[model samples]
Target: MRGSRVLSATFGYLGLTVAALFFLLPLLWIVVTSLKTPEQLFQYPPRWWPEHPTLENYTYLFSKMPFIRYSFNSLKVAGLSTIGSVVSCSLAAYAFARLRFAGRTALFYVLLATLMIPYQVTMIPVFILMRSLGWVDTYYPLIVPWFFGGAFGTFLLRQFFLTIPTELDDAAKIDGCSAFGIYRRIYLPLAGPALTALAIFVFMFQWNDLLTPVIYLSDPDKFTLTLGLAFFKGTVVTRWNLIMAGAVISAVPILIIYLAAQRYFVQGVALTGLKG
Candidate 1:
């Protein structure tokens, strides 16, 4: 039995090691390619590591372009969108979890049903609405919609809210707590891990959103990091080195956020899945 268990453990470790390398290969290649010189890029058989790595690509990207401004724009949009998503989704989730209202069950079901509809179906209508509001060229198109709770966010938070015992709600009510008060004082505090996880999700979604930005933002000055990165591609040729460097830079914040909240992220996911 001990010999069998040892063999199983060895295989598991070997499998995990292989999987890690498989996933890391593309990232490793991107980092290596980003460091290579232009001459080295066109070599018949590409080398894994750059013979001489330099920061010139990054330097040129920053000095020649308004890369910092683009980064700031992404930060602002993503930050606001994430904040909006959390607040709006939490409020909606609270209502769904606690409130007894007319058509509440039907309404919740309908809201969840909307998730099955493709975004592409509503894309044109939303674009037209934004254009009518004179928000076509502005950040409003990107940020405003998030303030209305998304189906997934509300559903996730509601699942978390459901896990909390109802006796707390009853006690809060007896203590003269209003609906808002119960939500703010009782549920919100208990839902911290879930909220953090949701925030991370919303931020990552907004940060890496390429299609929305590409459709809404036309001016280079207002372009987010994803859109700004597109400048490296031209009709004649593409700058792979600079693009890869910019991609690496753009990915840093996402990695940082995920790593920082990883504990809560796992906890939130687990708890939300428990009752739901």
Candidate 2:
């Protein structure tokens, strides 16, 4: 029995290691490719590691374009979007979970139905609205819509909120706390895991968003990292090395955020749907 258990553990570890390598090899290759020169990029037989790694590609990327500005723009839009989504979604979720109102369930179901409607279906209409409002070519179109909350975020948070005991709400009410006060003091503090998870989701979406930025923003100075990376492909030739470098740079903040909130993220996902 002990021997069988040992063999099972060994196989489990081996399988996990193989899975890790499967996902990591591409990222490793991107990092390696970013350091190679133009000549090494298209060698007859590709090199796993560059003979002489260089920072020239990264330097060229920064000097040739407003890469720093692009980074700042991405950060600004992602940060604001995350903040807006978290606040708006949490408030909406609280209402759906706790408040008594006519047609509350119907309204939530409508919101969920919206999630089934593809963004492509509304893309043209939304763009026309933005254009009519004179928001085209501005960050307003990129950042403002998120303040209204989203279906997925509301649903996720509402599920998590429902898991919390209503006795706490009664206790808060006994203390003469208003509905807003109960949410701010009790629910918000206890919903940390769900909030972190939602923030990470919203931030990642905004950070990697290319289509919205392309549709709304034409100014080079306002380009986000994803849009800026597209500039590396010229009509005549593409710079793979520079593109890889930009990809690495764009991936850093996401890695940092995931690592920082990984604990809460896992817990949030685990506990969110326990009740419903």
TM-score of each candidate structure, all chains considered together:
0.93, 0.93
Model 1, 3-118: lDDT tens digits are 99999999999999999999999999998888877887788699998779988887877888778889999999999999999999999999999899999999899999998899
- Per residue, candidate 2 scores C-alpha lDDT tens digits across 141-194 of 889988998888898899889989999999989999999999999999999888
- TM-score leader: 1
In model 2, what are the clashing residue pairs, if there are any?
none
Report how far off residue 80 is in candidate 1 (Å): 0.5
- TM-score attained by model 1: 0.93
The runs of at least 3 residues in candidate 1 whose Cα sits more than 4 Å from the true structure, single-residue gaps closed, are 267-276
